[model samples]
Target: MISTPPPDWNSYVQSGIHQPNLPTIQEINKAEFAPNVIRLGTGELSPHLFPRERMKQIFHRLANLIDSLGYEEPKGLLFLREQLSKYLKTIGIEASSSTILIVSGALQALQLISISLLQRGSTIFLEKPSYLYSLHVFQSAGMRLFGLPLDENGVQTKMITKQKKRQNASLLYTIPSFHNPTGILMSEERRRELIDVCEQERLI
Candidate 1:
């Protein structure tokens, strides 16, 4: 059940047009199955962990801004990006506010990458049994996904060459820090080698 996309979307997205839906979510909406449905699907923060008072004050300040009600810049609020840039720099990520293009959430970012960056039939290399494998966004985009084996450290970069030969991988998506589901973090050495390999392969 699919149709052509609106003209606003790029050809890459339009070419792979398919009806998108979460079957499990639809089933949940249709029936009540469990009192405590464990969601092992995505990386999500618990609502109980939120500091309500702190968020209330933050939103109160945001409401006072003159342009708060208006549509935000495509890149996102500059002030927020500037603050984020400073925070990332403190953690050794050298980035600027201008370079930070914000999206609503990880799902939005993935979908945007699929529509804007990924082409139909392009291959994406990722971790074996990753949360990415559970997502339909890439599949819906008509992109082929391949999962590489992982160890105690992280993905086996040694397999990169073999996987590349099997498929033309244009993108390598990874959750290096506190990876979802497995909760394993990639070692610094492994991270460096992975980056070097990606650079050498001209992967995004």
Candidate 2:
């Protein structure tokens, strides 16, 4: 009897509105959940680092104080938004509760923004070798990703000008504070420059 070759499973993943996560990203997701493995790249904290008692206290208060378990308003729970507004004030940011929109997490927030705000074929300028590369949310939504080089200071803002025009990029995404994977903190001066360039280019 003749031996048949193994099937190429990857050939089934056709490109379309939804794209599969990169092979490395899929591997990393599985590796993170493996027993005896410590996830260094993920945002999750170790069990010991979690504030268990404080969280329990908060949950206890919510169980007693929360009056309704019904679905929240479209934006989210008004009470939570109000609290978030107040917290923003303490950080020198003034935002009204009515303007606040809370989501489950950062991934959901990005997915919402990708579909709601961006048009199909829009380009997003982001730092090269970014954590965003690990996520297909934007790409799956019919947007393109353009990588901007990074230096010691942070993502090279100067490149945004020509590249923005060339790619017709609609917006930029960045993690300036303790940037994931790279761990490069953007300098204040570079931040200012980035703002200026974006403002000048009218690229939000």
Candidate 3:
């Protein structure tokens, strides 16, 4: 049998509307799957941390309980959303099940927000060294990301007002607790200030 050569992946990636993942991210994605490798600071949980037995039991239970494998509601399963609401309450977020939209994952949630909420040419304020920079979710949707400097507390709220007015920024994306890459947890005072700033500036 004759062999066929694979298409040029690099060309496809270059021509695509969505920007490619950062080189370091690409390396991390591939390296994490390699045998005997320990991935630290990556998005996914470690393999060793997975509850294999619990997952098996849950799957078995689900197999019996769930009669149909048909499509779920746009917001996802009701029970899951209810549970998430309860969980969020514990963390001081008073979200109702009706308000909650359960996405497949964080990336999907980001993509949904990027495309649905904001208009083209909208600006987003984010941490200077954010995980969002590695992904072009907002950028691909015709929005811009303006990075704010971070300190021990978290992203500098002081800069937000000026930047918001200057760039006409519409949204602020933050990982307050245990921020990605840097791992700088936002202080309670900082969180309050951020909320205040957002309210005053009318930034979401």
RMSD of each: 6.3, 4.5, 4.6
Residue-level lDDT of model 3, residues 32-102, one tens digit each, is 77878875556578678899999999998889778668988898899889999999999999999999988
- TM-scores of all candidate predictions against the true structure: 0.72, 0.84, 0.78
| Highest-TM-score candidate | 2
How would you encode candidate 2's per-residue C-alpha lDDT over 1-204 as one tens digit per residue?
989988776665654556777787789888988988887777678889899999999998879788888999999999989999999999999999999998988878888888899988899998887885434778788888899999999999889987877899998999898888889999999999999999999988
The lDDT-based order of candidates, best leading, equals: 2, 3, 1
lDDT of 1 by residue, 1-204 (tens): 899766665555546555344687578544543557655444555678889999999989878666656888999988889999999999999999999998888767887888788877888898886774335778877778899999989988988877786788989888898877688899999999999988877778
Give the whole-model CA lDDT for all candidates, comma-separated: 0.79, 0.86, 0.86
The C-alpha stretches of model 1 lying farther than 4 A from their native spots are 1-34, 38-40, 60-63, 85-99, 132-134
* Cα-based lDDT at residue 86, candidate 1: 98
Quote the positional error of residue 81 for candidate 3 in Å.
Answer: 3.1
Give the worst 10-residue stretch by lDDT in candidate 3: 132-141
Candidate 2 structure, TM-score to reference:
0.84
**Per-residue lDDT value at 128 in model 2:** 88
The worst-scoring run of ten residues by lDDT in candidate 2 lies at 9-18
